[model samples]
Target: MSEIIRFYSVTDDYGEFSNFAEYPVTLKKVRWPTSEHYFQSQKFKDKKDQQEIRKANSPMLAARMGRDRKRKLRRDWESAKVNVMREAVFAKFTQHEELRELLLSTGDAKIVEHTENDDYWGDGGDGRGKNMLGRVLMDVRQALRDDA
Candidate 1:
């Protein structure tokens, strides 16, 4: 098995792998401060709500806004969330050469978003979560490798 690389906060080792890391991505002619912002903004059906998340000063704020139940979520959001995250991750790595290089440098290592905050996107602090974000990163890494 390849080495395991776990990343959570932006201050930790492999921090660049964190969605909150300072990286900009442009998708659909709009720029987002980070992949987190892009992914979160996409949960809503309303363009105005999406715009609000896109304009948030920080990824954390964008996440908060995205989770606000008062705002209407897209009907297909639950089904489309993984693809949405994939799109954001792909855009982030492709748009930044350094970030692309960083991801590629991981080689075949198992990338994991090690956090207890969300079981779906993280490791659940006990390795029981889905780690979907990590899977997306690895998928993007493979795609980049194939393109090389």
Candidate 2:
């Protein structure tokens, strides 16, 4: 098997794979700062709340805003988050040729979001977590490859 490709910070070797990387994505006719912005904004049903996250100066701030319990999270967020993230990630790669190429360059290597921050989106620093983000990325990679 090819070696696993692990990424976490925007400064990592495969940083472009990170949602926090400086890659803008447009979804639903609205331009967002990054995939992180798009994904975080989607957690809330309120347009105002979503816009606030979209306008956040950094992905980290956007993440924090998305985690704000004071804001009203969408009722379907729990069930819809994976798809939401998939959409944002797909848009990110499709919109940017360089990023798409970067993703494609990985070939069939396993992509991993290596971090302990969130078990659902990352490997939880020990490979026990779900790594949904990595799964979505690989899925998009396959879709892109199929289109090529």
Candidate 3:
């Protein structure tokens, strides 16, 4: 059995992100990419919106977009949103100093999605698999130490 360690998590209708702390800190500015980032990175999930995204990405034309990108985003918000959320949460931890510090203080802390079977990210590693988020956090911790 893996060593029993303290892990933090939040739960609701969506799911959970474990191995985090219950720190009373909020981000000053959320410098994280959103589902909008997925829309921007990939394209519209709706078949009808594909043409618009294609046109927008065309070399001859630029996608004139407002803050929210209007209807040029993925319509299926309930499907396969974990990847987007992962990026966002990771960004949140990395961009904010308070959160980063809080996270680093928790040595070997991890982030696991309660509802998903993500071996690459969730609790697949009982000291034997990849914990991508934890690895990143530790990397940041190392960087911070180096900076100090």
Candidate 4:
């Protein structure tokens, strides 16, 4: 058995209706062979071919293009880390109303305390911070629920 991560890109702009009607598309697959190797073998070759074609047209343009590509890659990696942290925080806060209220009343401390159990909060090997935005959202929801 193989584990796969599915990603979908939405193209419609109808807001509610668009999301309701949107279909999930599988972007790629990770199998016995590592995704890195797969990408390096096939995807990298294809990308290199395209870059060569573009470079032939202009040398200075290609150099500038390479720099842009590197920057984009770094940005994407950082964004991914942030997203993971956000989701973790969201999940934790949504799971319990009390936690949410504590967050809204006192602040991030309540949420941070919860994340401390997880490695991502810096207590363990994970590099995530305790005061991530997602955790704060959870705290807010809990606070509202408690007042009700």
Which candidate leads in lDDT?
2
Off by over 4 Å in 2: none
True-vs-predicted CA distance for residue 137, candidate 4, Å:
6.7
The predicted structure with the larger TM-score, 1 or 3, is 1
Worst 10 residues of 2 by lDDT: 1-10
lDDT string, candidate 3, 18-60, tens digits: 3222222122232112222322333355544543433343211
Query: lDDT tens string, model 2, 1-148?
Result: 4789999999999999999999999999999999999999999999999999999999999999999999999999999999999999999999999999999999899999999887999999999999999999999999999999
How much is the lDDT of residue 31 in candidate 1? 85
| Model 3 pairs in collision | none
What TM-score goes with each of the models?
0.97, 0.98, 0.39, 0.26
Q: Cα-based RMSD of the predictions, in order? A: 0.8, 0.7, 11.3, 16.8
Residue range 1-148, candidate 4, lDDT tens digits: 1321111112222111111111221113312121112212222224553334233333234334433443333334444644433433443344445534443544222222222434432323232444343343444445555766
Model 3 regions more than 4 Å off: 1-91, 107-116, 125-128
- Candidate 1 lDDT over residue span 1-148, tens digit each: 4699999999998898888999999999998899989899999878999999999999999999999999998999989999999999999899999999999999999999998887999989899999999999999999999999
State which candidate has the highest TM-score: 2
Per-residue lDDT of 112 in model 4: 28
Q: Which ten residues in a row have the lowest lDDT in candidate 3?
A: 23-32
lDDT of each: 0.92, 0.96, 0.41, 0.32
Model 3 CA lDDT for position 89: 52
